[model samples]
Target: MVIRAEDVRRSYGETVALDGVSFSVEAGEVFALIGPNGAGKTTLIRALTGTTDAEGTVELFGAPPTDVARHRIGLLPQEFSPAGRLTARELVAYYAGLYDESRDVDAVLSDVGLEDSAGTWYENLSGGQKRRACVGTALVNDPELLVLDEPTTGIDPTGRRDLWRLVERLADGGTTVLLTTHYMEEAEELADRVGLLADGRLVTLGSPGELVARHGGDSRLVVEAEDEMAASRALESAGYDLLPDERHVAVPVGPEEIPAVVEMLEAADVEYGGLVWRQPSLDDVYVALTGTDVTAGGDPIEGGRP
Candidate 1:
């Protein structure tokens, strides 16, 4: 195992940040930890990096994450702010000195698509470019494990895809990664396995598809109709199921029942603008297990997100 954490617990006075959480990460695997804000995801990451006090059996690189093991790990913290005055190259070079080693600063910069911005001052870079620079700093040491916390939070879709590709390429080359994200799509797209955390506990753990399958068994058919009530009643009368929403009626149907539901809608002359079938996803899994949306930031699902 690249990471082995068992019964980990952390507390701050009256508040328990991590409550006997346990999980493991295999070498060369991309494992994602997802939870709402204040769910102790950051607390666990801090403990694993040996930056905070905690009670647990935690190991990295098959040993305690001491000075030696720490050197083999690269971290892109959620709140990263490089020195405003330093150029990208200077930032990476400074980190290289910490490892007491020399690295191809240019290569690391280029790997993260930052070669052209090597001379740009860290504070002047765009949000995505700054993120890229931070990533370069993390990679200069060529560590065995990479830990990222919300690595692409503010990046645009195209830049986000580029970063995703880079992370995937790194894993393909035998680097183990552990990440925390609010974006369920990122977890579904990049993770071989995902662990859902809530209120300092490991709620569930499994492959993305397995979690989705375990939590969501029915396909959802969403219809947009001018008269949603009549359409809903027609489907309900025909024994089609209604999901838990009112803006647009969603019917729960199996593969074989899909055609039947469509035909029934047509025959009943229920005017629908469009119909779409949505498969189960990690978003569904999270909502099912936590009873709240990932973007809800630990609030009850009905409490509107801020």
Candidate 2:
């Protein structure tokens, strides 16, 4: 394992930040830590990096996270602020000096698409530019393990796509990465395995497709009825689990039950606005497990960091 944590726990006064969390990251794989605000993603990251005190067994590259191990790990923290007076090139070079063996500073800058802004002062760059610079700093050491916390937040669509490509390239080159983000699309795009944390606990962990298959079953039947209350009552009477929304009522039903649903709607004269049948997605898996809208308020597990 490139990164390992066993029985990790932490607390701040009365609130428990992490509760016996355990997970591992295999070499050359992209592992994503996903959750909502206050889910302890940051807390766990801090513990793993040895930036905070906690009770756990943590190892990086087969040993404790000592100075040598720290040199082999690239960490892009969630809240990063560069010195306002330092130019991008200077900032990256300063970080490069921390590692025993560092990559070419120019190559690192170009890798993150920040070569053009090399001379720009850190505080003068745009938000996206600043984020890219931060990523560049992390990559300067060419570490074997990359630990990124919301690395793409505030980036434009183009920048976000570029960052995803960079992550893929890193993984393909045998670099193990442990990342945390609130964006499901980002997780789906880059992760080989995702660990969902909720309320400081691991709720689920699997590949994107595997998670959907395990937690989100078949497609749902969406019905927009004129009278949602009556339709919900009818669905309950029929023993179907009705998921209500302001615009429509969704029910889980097998393919054979589709005809019956249409008939019931017609008989009850419930005028539906539209209907859609589609395969389950990660959002469905989240709703099924967390009992909340993943698309609306975001994943509660990561604690709304991104």
Candidate 3:
């Protein structure tokens, strides 16, 4: 395994960040740690990288997480702000200097799709470009393990896709990647396995398909109704389940059952904007495990970074 955590726990005064969390990552595997905004994802990353002292055992490449292993595992931190004074090339060169065995700075930049921006000043780069530059620095050491926290937090769709392709290529070339992000699609895209964290606990752990199969239902029916109240009455009467938030009613059905649902809705004259049919995903899995909307009801633990 490239990374391992056993019974990891972190506390700040009375606040508990991680509660006996344990997981492991294999060589060349892409794993994701996903949770709400303040559910201790960042804290866990800190512990794995040896930036924070938590009570538990964490190993990087079969050794304790310490300065000796720091050079072998790269980090693109949650609060990554590049030094404005340095250009892209200069910044990567600076990161390369930190490791005894480092890849060429230019090669690192090229690997992250930043070769054209090598001369661009850090402060002058766009948000996505800056993120790519940060990734370049993380890749400079060609570390065995890459830890990325919210790597595409504020990036546009195109830029986010570009970065994802970079990460995919890295993982395909035999680098182990561990990341945390609120974007479920990103996890769906890159994670070979996912661990869902909620309120300082690992609620679910499995491959996307496994989790979805275990917790997720069949095809979901999403209808935007003209009248929420009437729509609820009609759907519930016809044996379709409604989510707590009725703005969009979700029903579990197979492809053949879709027509049955549409038949009922049409019979009731339910005026809907549209009906969308889609497969179960990580979003549904998270909501099922947490019993709350993934984006709702989260306050940071005391002394915890958001």
Cα lDDT tens digits for candidate 1, 1-306: 899999999877777888999999999999999988877887888888887778989988777777545568899888788789999999998988888664689988888788888999999988998998888888878889999988887887887888899999999999999999888889999999999988889999999989988995567888898898899899889987788833589987666677887899999999999888888888788778878877776522212112
**TM-score per model over all chains:** 0.91, 0.83, 0.92
- The TM-score measured for candidate 2 stands at 0.83
Q: In terms of TM-score, which candidate is stronger, 1 or 2?
A: 1
Misplaced by over 4 Å in model 2 are: 221-247, 251-277, 293-306
Residue pairs clashing in model 3 are none
Q: Which ranges of candidate 3 are over 4 A from the true structure?
A: 236-246, 297-306
The reply for model 1, stretches above 4 Å from the true place, is 245-247, 254-260, 298-306
Better of 1 and 2 by lDDT: 1
Please list the C-alpha lDDT of all candidates, in the order they appear. 0.84, 0.83, 0.85
